[model samples]
Target chain A: MNILVLLRMVPDVVEELEIAPDGRTLDTEYLRMIVNESDDHALEQALILKERKGGKVTVLALDAPDVDDVLFSAVAKGADRVMKIEGGDGGVTTRAAAGMFAEIIRNEKDLQPFDIVLTGVQAIDDLDALVAPILSHRLGLPYLAIVTKVTPDATGKSVTAIREFAGGVRGEFDVPLPAVLGIQAAEKPPRYVPVAKVRAAMKTSKIESIGVPTMADGGQPLLDVSHMRKPVVSGHAQMLDGEPEDVSKKLAGIFTERGLL
Target chain B: MSGNIWIVAEQWRGKLSEITFESLALGREVADGLGVKLQAVLLGHDVQNLSTSLGMADSVIYVDHTELADPGASAQASALAQLVRQQKPRTVIVPLTNVSLGTGTLLGEQVGAPVVNFCKDLRAADGHIVADCVLYGGKIEATVTPRGDLTVIGLWPGSRPPDKGRSDRNPPVETQTVTFADQPSVKLRSYIEPDASDVDITQQDVLVAVGRGIQSQENVALAEELAASLGGAVCGSRPVIDQGWLPLSRQVGKSGLNVKPKLYLALGISGAPEHLEGMKDAPLIVAVNSDPDAPIFNVAHYGVVADAMDMIPTLKETVLALRG
Candidate 1:
């Protein structure tokens, strides 16, 4: 079985985030980059699945030369091949990114045997949580989001995922083979790649592109960012004094006033 | 007359959340800004009668049902779609809870609207509704204009101003309750609520989060003491949550609860995107991390480059003195 994981190279959230002078998007200069957090989990899940079924894992990223280090780094963690989707930033719209990514799975050479494609429920950058569904629709594959636990049957090619819904609700879903999933982080964590292994793999790994796909309508910039400033806060931090009993009562009153209880 | 902006009131066990009323207030302001009316769409079993007592904003689109408590997303969507057909509201506002997102997503699709999730600011633009959101790890601001005939926005926890909204449209004595022709497919199998002891940081107005600088698990006692002194909840980052130092409920981030408290004071916690996404909406963020370069300072209102170890005792003294 073959597995494909979508890896995104986003600006590190640590430094002060800024949009480019053009104001079309994130400013790349003076920024550190990291792999999407959930994609790590997706990679880790794929590696574990590979160990059991003896299939290969391929990670696809829409990135630049700088992202090649990350692609090779993923190899050290366990994936077999890393495919880069080349071109300048504006890769795909939120609505169509998943569809474009699904195309990567179909077009990759010798990787057609993949049985599953996994993603984080939402990339931290987008937060729209739209990729898995859009990909599922374009690929005609079943999908689920907010998955907390997964149990894959060794005898069968299906994996069961339990997801958290609203009002603290839970849903149990049985996803069959060849389905895509937006894995919640706790479903698994992506293990780190050893620097030594990354260096060795970089010597031989080929980072190629499948061309950057855009929105069908020449890709309208979905959104424009005007400002990046911290919100002003009102009111001071209120402190509650006294014993535990008194504190509880005070909190209960506050909760009643706030309608939380 | 203020053109009506209706908030679909969500109730359970006869109790309504101020969250609903808060959004209603924001809706009223939006209505006023557009020279329209403010209305509320109240849906629940025998809930139409409670509109006025619950701060009836404008008109109310109430749905009554005994089985409404079952919480099938399809049912809520069906009823909301009916309301959309009847009232043709310019914008429909809902909380970001799972119940709202599931049903809201479905309704937005059926209504041919855009459902903007976790919006931080809202306004009227180009004959439609627009919002400014803290997107991409709170690093970028997205000013989104909801597209389609009607717009749907998921309000973040603390984005709306509390007192900037009010309306005077008398709650009509009785309102119409529309029925959904097609019902939900998923049936309710008796809900088993999580234990009351579930770490419920979302319910707190104030949060004092501790981070990696605690050095050792025993040092967590300092945080506990601070939580006790401040009468606020104590939550941790993924490291602390994963280390079993705190329950998963006390975990704050994208995977955990997305909370926006009145005041969030960070004690020795480094600011990572995963952790920042959870609490970025906190209106008054104060960081006391020893490292001046900790990412927590980017969004913090006040930065204390001093050691949190020393600040905790001083903070306790400052607050305790104020309480007197």
Candidate 2:
């Protein structure tokens, strides 16, 4: 049972995002990038599966700001191999990204015969969340999204996935091996690796860099962004100010007026 | 290119989902704008009667198959793709939900059409469709146009009023047939429903919602105390529920319960679109977060740019003191 997990770096929404001068993209100069929350869960799920099934785990990521740190951290978290694909400056669409990944998984002789491919269910940037399904379609394999758990059968020919639907409804499915899954959460929270361990792993681990393939004409983005801007603040909220006590007093007054208290 | 507009009606457990109606409302607007027919595509086993409620569309395309009864994304996409290939609808609208999340993308790939997902709004612009899509959890908005004539749009929930999509008049139903080339590799085993023994957050009039800003399980007690003093209940965003600080029953978001409390006190919640979908309709919403730019403020009636941890204790005391 060999597992492959895909990691993506997304703009850290904790920091303010400013539109670039182009008005069609984010300003990359001051942007802080972090591993997408759900992608971190995908890596954690892959590691858990490796631990339970005695298989090798490989983490793949496209090139982006602070990507090296992410790959090194994956090594510290018990990933057996880390691979980085060059030439992604964080502007690629999900369709194009999926095409690149499918190419690598099929053409790369070294990363052959993977039983499973795991990726985040959705990224904040690409909320469309099309990569896993498009990739699965390209690879001619089964695909499942919003999966919380994966358990392999004794024969290793298939795996059972616990998929979540809207409103807390969950469905269990038997997916044959060599499938793609969009992970919503791992059974456990992502494990934190110490900086020292990452540093140590960085010294011993080698990140195999793969060059970007020449994409076909279909790789062109279907959706072209005409403009990107911050949401217009309606200023609907009557902002309360001052010390905590003062604000609390005002809130209490409002609640009393509304008969909530 | 002149073509019909299609809305893939989402159904679960023999009933159509809310997002289906939302898509119909949106699809109707786009269809009328483009001067094309609005068609609702319903695919399920023994579910032809579901078409009666889809009067919002000019017509309903019904497909019946046992394999589609509990279909995976692939089976559903394949069936839809077969119809799309034959009909060549200019735009296919799919609802972005956990059940049909992958359908649009899979259909786009299968039919060689481009997909624009997370679409909150769509309109015909100069005989072409344009979409307003939310990005980065509603921090940014992008106006997008598809480069191709035929495209798939994944409509997000809360995009339109579901009431506008409901109609008493039955639409003409057109039955379609599709055969799968191969058996779907994913087979449903069983559905694990949520725990029903816990409190129903939707019934509460007042909900004090917490998020990652609450930090730890111990901090949840603060929210609980605040809710208790207010004669309300304590609920949380997905982060807090995922962290095990609260039960799944207490989550207030898309995957959780769609709550419409009279007063929604949001503490530390940033108000992602998913979270907003559940609670934005509250009669009164007040939010407190360290980030003044949190999207919660967009929908909140009153907001405070302060730490929730510091405000919770004072709020509880103030409510108690005011009541006295």
Candidate 3:
């Protein structure tokens, strides 16, 4: 079972993001980049599958800020190898990234066809959530999204997957082996790697670098943002005044006026 | 064939989802802007009656197949791909749901068309579609132009109201038959639904939703007491449910039930986009949290910057006294 996990670095969601002067994208200055939360889980999922099924687990990510740290961390957490593809300014569309990744997966001399590819169901940065599907399409592989559980068949030619539906409903599927899956969650909480172990792996492990041939306008990004502005609060929120007690009293009065009492 | 806009009207088990109508509402606008006709594409085993409800479209197109009775993403995508190939509609708008996430992506890939997913807003600009997309958990918005002659879009639910497309005139329904290749690679085996709760939050007129700020399981009782006093139902966000303080049925968000109660008292709920998408339509929203900068304040009709734990009990007492 050869598993490939795609990871991405997104802005630390805790920090405030401001629109650039162009009013189109985020302001990069002072922004802290962190491994997207779900992508971390994707790595953990791949590692668990590798441990159980006895295969090599490779972590793939774009060459973005703090990406090397993420790759080294994956190595410390038991990934067999890590690769960083050159190019990507943190704003590349998912389709463009998928195109590049497809090329790398197919052309990398040391790599073989992976039996399973896992990615976070969605990324916080782009939120288009198109990467895994586009990659699957580019590779002519079966694709499944919002998957929570994956169990490889005894023959290893197929895997049974559990997909999540609305209202907490779940569906089971029998997906073929050579497939791309958008993971909704890992089998368990991501195991924590001590900081010292990660630091040690930084000296022992080397991240393979690969250059990707850019596609047309880098996949001719489907849409161009003409303009952007802060989302207006349409509810016309009325801020209640005074202390908590006074506000509670006022809320009670409003509820009484509306007969919600 | 090239300029018309199409909406893949989504239905399951003979019923149309709300996002289906919402897609039509937005599709109508796109069609008008592109100077083209709007069409609804319905796929199911026997959905002729449901197609009539999409009266806003200029025409309704449907494909009835037994395999579609419980359509998975691959089945729907294969069916829609055939439709797209036959009728080269410039744009196909699909509802942004977990199910459509794969269907829409594969359909676009099948036709070699560009796809823009999770669109909150769309407009035609210079013969192209410009979209406003929410990113980083709705903290930032990006405007994108899906640069292609053919675009497949996943319209976010709640972007437009379903009633906006309501009309007296029923569109003509057109039926088409296409051979569906067996989707052997993936097959749906079974569905597991959450256990039913005592109170159906969907039917409740008022909801008091608690979030992580509620702290412990005991703190949940405060919100319950408040809900009881105000004649409302008690619910919680995903965190509370994950902790077993509430059942899965009581969860409200993109993955849970969408509720539009008359009043929503959000306690300690920092409005993530997922949670807000479910209840933002509530007529009167009152939020209480210790952090004033919580996103819940943006959609709330009334807000108080205080700990929900400190205020819930007093608020319940105040409501009781006022009712008397």
Candidate 4:
């Protein structure tokens, strides 16, 4: 079985953002990048599936030439091979970056018309969470988003996966082989990246690079951000002076007065 | 087609959600600025007459069918894509629900256009719509131009104000029965809706929504108190339901009850477009978060940058006093 996981490298979400002097964009410097959080889970889920069923695992990402720290980490943890494509400077939107990655996947001759594919339900960076479906369409494969679990057959032909619907109802799908499944949070985080094997994986693993694809339809937001500064709601909120019950009542009253309750 | 703002008026299972009307309200804001006709594309199963409410549009286009009941990404995208190919509206606005997320992005890709996945800040100018949205767990806001060469945008639910009024003026948009595959990869053989005997938090006039910002299951009482003081119901984001902190019925998001209430107080909630899409129709939004950086403040009209825990105590008292 051949398994492909879409790994994205994004600016460390924890880092404070700096707005350029001009409000139109954010400054990319002082930003540290890492493998997307949910993609980490995607890789982990792929690793577990490989351990039980035994398939070659490939992790693909779009980033600058030097996203090797995170790519090496992916290898140390599980991936048999890591492919890094030069898709401009890293950390673009899901629309732009996924186009580049999809282009790379379509071009790769080594990958055995993948038996199954997986990605996080939503990447932490773009939060658009729309790519897996788009990728599924672009690849002409069926897609199921927010899949909680997957149970595959030995031949990698058919699989039954649990998907969450509205109101906690779990629906099981009898999906055919070679479908893309976007994984949500799983029962376990990917197994830790052991230090002993980390050095060897980094030394031996080859990071294959590729070219970026042009984005077709990036949407216009009616309102554009003047800057990428950290969110700031600057004002001292009035503390309602009272005890618990009284405070509760007072808060309700305040909202009512404002026609908000 | 060349100079009109495209509004995909969303209706599901015969009824239009409040966000549909709200989109028209926001759409007009774009239409007026672009100095073009307002076009509303209404999709639903047997919703032929539903387009009547969208009288404000210069043209109200209708695509109705019973198959739309099970609208999925591929089906809806193919239909909307056909409509786009024919009309070529300057911008397309879809409500930011899971189905919308799937279909809107798919259409964007099929047409090779940019789509604002979710945006609170949506405006149109110079034959283009520009949007700003938060990504990366509310860490940073990325500026997007929906009109950029080929980009179109999906509307962020709670960020835009609710509909105040719409025009009674009328001109019917030409109706077309879009021919796309209505095939759901996974067919819904039947829908076993939850027994309506159960009370849903979304129906209540007031909702005290607890987000991940709230610490533990035990701390839910702080939010419950506020709910009690206002004679309202309480709900939580997905994690709360996932953790068994609240009944799954209390979960609010794309997968849960969409609500439009008089008031919605988001506590300790970092507003994801998923959660916000469900409640953006609430007439008044107030948010409380310790981290001023939380994205909830973006759409919130009245917010206090403070710990929701401490603020809940004081706010509850304020509610009690006001109720008195």
Candidate 5:
């Protein structure tokens, strides 16, 4: 089995995000980029499948700030191969990114034909989560999102995917091989790779660099952002005054008045 | 090109989801703004009766097919694309949800229409539509415009109140037929329901919700005590549920149960947009988190900048004494 995982570095939301001077983009200065949470899970899922079924796991990432560290870390986490597509930046829209990924996956000569392609269900930046579907449409492959687990048949002809729906309901689907999946979570939490291991892999492993192909139609952006800003604060909360004791006392009084107690 | 405004009605397990109604309310506003008819596009098998409740739409465009019975993204997208191509609606609004997430994007891809997702508000501006969208989990907002004659919008939930979308009048229902060239490759085999033994968080009038700040499973017991004192139930944010600190049924978020409790006590929850989508409708919200800048405070009626771990035990004791 040959499994391909797509990794994306998104602006870490834990830090304060500043709007760039362009007014339509984020400030890259002092910005921290980290592996999108679910993308890490996608790598973990691919690794788990490889461990069980004996397969090669190749991880691919677009060029962006701090993306080299993510690709190197994937190598430490048991990825068989890691490739970086150059000329791509963090500001690319999901549509353009999907186009680039499809182009690379189709044209990369050294990589083996992949039976499964996996990516995170969504990213914080691109909350619309259109990459997998658009990529699947371009590749003419079956697509499934919010998948929690994947099990391949002994014949390797198809796989059963466990997809999550709202309200704690899960649906199992039978998808043929050569499909794309938007992994919501892995069977286990992503395994932690130590800093020392990542450093060692950075010294030993070679990250294959491939130039991004000229995008079709220059990747016309479907949606254009006219303005970007912080969310307007609607109503400010009446902040409670003092120590835990005083606050709890006041909260209890309100609860009693509201008949919640 | 001038045309009608369309909303794709989402149904699962024979009932329409709340986001469907929310979309209708938003569609009604945008439609009224654009001076166009609001149309509800209902596609499902044996589900024509569901259209009666969609009175907000000027008309109900119904398409019944066996392949669309299970909410497969590809089949529904194909059907919707065909309808869009033929009908030429000005805008197609789809709810951004787990069940219908891929429909809008795939339809856009199929029909060569521009799509704007995560839309919080839409307005008619100078003969064009402008959408205010939330990005990066609600930290940043983007005002976007689709560059096309027809645009598909993936609307986020909680944009409009569901009650505003509900109406008593039955809209006109028009049935349409569509054919598929090939069967969808993804097939739904079975659905696993949540464990029935767990407490239903939606029914609780008072909820003490925990997030990553609850620290550990041991700390959850403290929250349980607080909930008991307040005659309520305990729920957690996605991070808490993801960490296995609570069962999936006890989760409160976009993928979990939507609860409108009388009093929602959010403890340590940073209020990611997904979590807010579930519980933002509560009557009274009070949040306690160490970080003052946590987004939970934005919607919270009252806030205390303190560690939830320190406040949970004290709050429980204080509530019990106040009741006595």
Candidate 6:
């Protein structure tokens, strides 16, 4: 019942993102990184499974500026072990990352016993949603995505997952052990780890690092942004200017013209 | 290995999903750019009638099997992989839904083709294909080129209008069969369909949709008041519902209800593709957010770079004054 959780650090979306001088990538000078929201949920789901089934939880993340803090936080939240894969400046494509992950899992002799591997269904930074599927494919395991719930069978041979489909439809699946899933959300919101506990975990735990030579040797990402510009808003929406009251009045005036009033 | 472009049409319960038609539209462009035929591969039991619907393609390849009537990822991937290996298409496109992601991924792995999901744009450039993909919830876009000889792509739904097949003649049809081993790795247990909600927000003329920017459940009342003043219904994005501030029935997104109102007032909604897909077709979109770079502004006709907290109250007052 051992579980492996793939965590990712993404640039915080709330902060203003600026294009670098290169014009194709984000300006990393003042960029802040945090755990990808869905990956946080995946880690939470893994911790919940461990708490219920008495299994070890191992968290894996690509090395990024704040990744050690994220791994330590996972440990504070009940992850048994955490490892940071070295390489990737947070710009690695999902396909290439999956290749490195598959390579690591295959070559790391001590890490081969995980019964299930889970990752965020999609990352805010990449939005490719291909890593789990590609990883599972490379490892020859069954793959499922948008999973909201996972339950182990009493016999411990299979796990049942509830997958969320478009339009609120939910499908329950019985996937065999040694499967991979793209978790959409945990059953509960990720539990909060107090700063004290995270500090203690930082002092007590050490993060193992795995060196990755090149994510591109076998699975190079073919896409690169040639240029980026602010998306021009379509539909020609009329922007209301001025103070809040004045803009609100203008909006009401337009609504009245439409006779909605 | 081959120049032809192929699209794996997704079907559920004997009917082709709209996404299948959309993929064809996208594939048509890629195929024309490559000066190749756009072909469709349909796999299902007794799906002969469905092949005719793919008039957008030059031809159709049908793989029939009983197990495919209720196909899982393994079965679908196995069948598609065999066909793809034999046909050796230059590129294969499938819808990036919860179901077909596995098919695309597994087939790519089996054939040593790299897979990229949620492609927003595709082009044939200098004898190679390139795709524009979004990251950071559409905040950043990256261009990706597949390295392998073969590429499998996952097309995002609503990327383009579904192609209307030719009314004059049906596309040529070719049938292929695949022998798939039993996929015992995953089994379908049950389906938990959501109950029909009492209120159908899709019928409303106006919808005030709130997101995480609304801050707290207490602030939701302000949005409700604004919605009430405008004589519209109040809906929310996934976060609000997840926080128990709104009912699941009132949630609007790919995983929630789809609404196409005359006016969609998005408050604090970051306009993730999920939420945008549900309401992008609305006639008029007005978005209010504190972040100027929020993706919602890209689609909104009218946007105010202000907090929903300040705007909602003033909006309500103005609406009430108009009513008076």
CAPRI class of candidate 3: medium
lDDT of 2 by residue, A1-261 (tens): 799999888998879999999999999999999998888989988999988998899988989989999999999999999999996555887778888888888889888889999999888877334779988998899899988888888889899999987777789999998999999888777888999999999899999999877666546777778999999865668899999999998998888898877
Top TM-score: which candidate number?
2
In the range A1-261, model 6's lDDT, one tens digit per residue, is 789998878889889778898877788899999988888889989989998999899888888889998999899999988999886555776767777888888788888788999998877655333678778767878778888889998989889998876666778988898999988888877889999999999999999988874544555555455665545445444566788998897777767776777
How much is B180 displaced in model 1, in angstroms? Answer: 12
Error of 4 at A236 (Å): 7.9
lDDT of 6 by residue, B1-324 (tens): 666899888887678878888888888888999898999999888888988888899999998987687546667878888988888889988777755656776677677777766677788988779987666776776677777678888777776687542324588999998996654467777878776855678889989999999998999988988999888989999778766688767889866878899889999999887788789888778898888788988888888888889899989988898788
Of 4 and 6, the candidate ahead on DockQ is 6
- Stretches > 4 Å off in candidate 5: A127-129, B215-218, B225-231, B313-324
Candidate 3 clashes between residue pairs 3 or more apart in a chain or in different chains: A222-B145, A222-B146, A222-B147, A223-B145, A223-B146, A224-B144, A224-B145, A225-B143
lDDT of 1 by residue, B27-64 (tens): 77687788777677777776666677445465566677
Candidate 1 structure lDDT: 0.63
Clash totals, every prediction = 13, 0, 8, 59, 0, 8
Per-residue lDDT tens digits for candidate 3, residues A173-220, read: 889879888887676656779999999999999998877665644565
Candidate number with greatest lDDT: 2
In model 3, which runs have C-alpha deviations exceeding 4 angstroms? A127-129, A213-217, A241-261, B125-128, B168-170, B180-184, B197-199, B203-234, B238-247, B261-263, B289-294, B305-324
Model 5 agreement with the true structure over B21-99: per-residue lDDT tens digits: 8989999988999899999999999999999999999999999999899977888899999999888999999988888
What are the RMSD figures for all models against the true structure?
A: 7.9, 1.4, 3.5, 5.8, 2.1, 2.6
For model 1, residues A1-261, the per-residue Cα lDDT tens digits are 677888776666656666677665567777777766666667777777787677788888876436888888877777788888777465354544554686666665576776778776665455332566556545655555656556676755677666655334456666677777766644444565678999988887777667866535343333334444443334223444554344445544553355433
Candidate 4 Cα errors over 4 Å, as ranges: A12-15, A32-37, A44-56, A64-80, A124-129, A149-175, A187-261, B64-67, B134-151, B159-162, B165-173, B181-235, B239-247, B257-268, B276-290, B297-324
DockQ of each: 0.15, 0.75, 0.50, 0.27, 0.67, 0.55
Q: For all candidates listed, what's the TM-score of chain B alone?
A: 0.69, 0.97, 0.88, 0.77, 0.92, 0.92
* Weakest ten-residue segment in model 4 chain B by summed lDDT: B182-191
The DockQ ranking, best first, is 2, 5, 6, 3, 4, 1
Higher-lDDT candidate among 2 and 6? Answer: 2
Q: Give the Å error, residue B97, model 4.
A: 1.3
TM-score of each: 0.70, 0.97, 0.87, 0.75, 0.94, 0.92
- Model 6 lDDT, residue A15, Cα: 90
- lDDT, candidates in the order shown: 0.63, 0.89, 0.80, 0.68, 0.88, 0.81
Interface RMSD of 4: 6.0
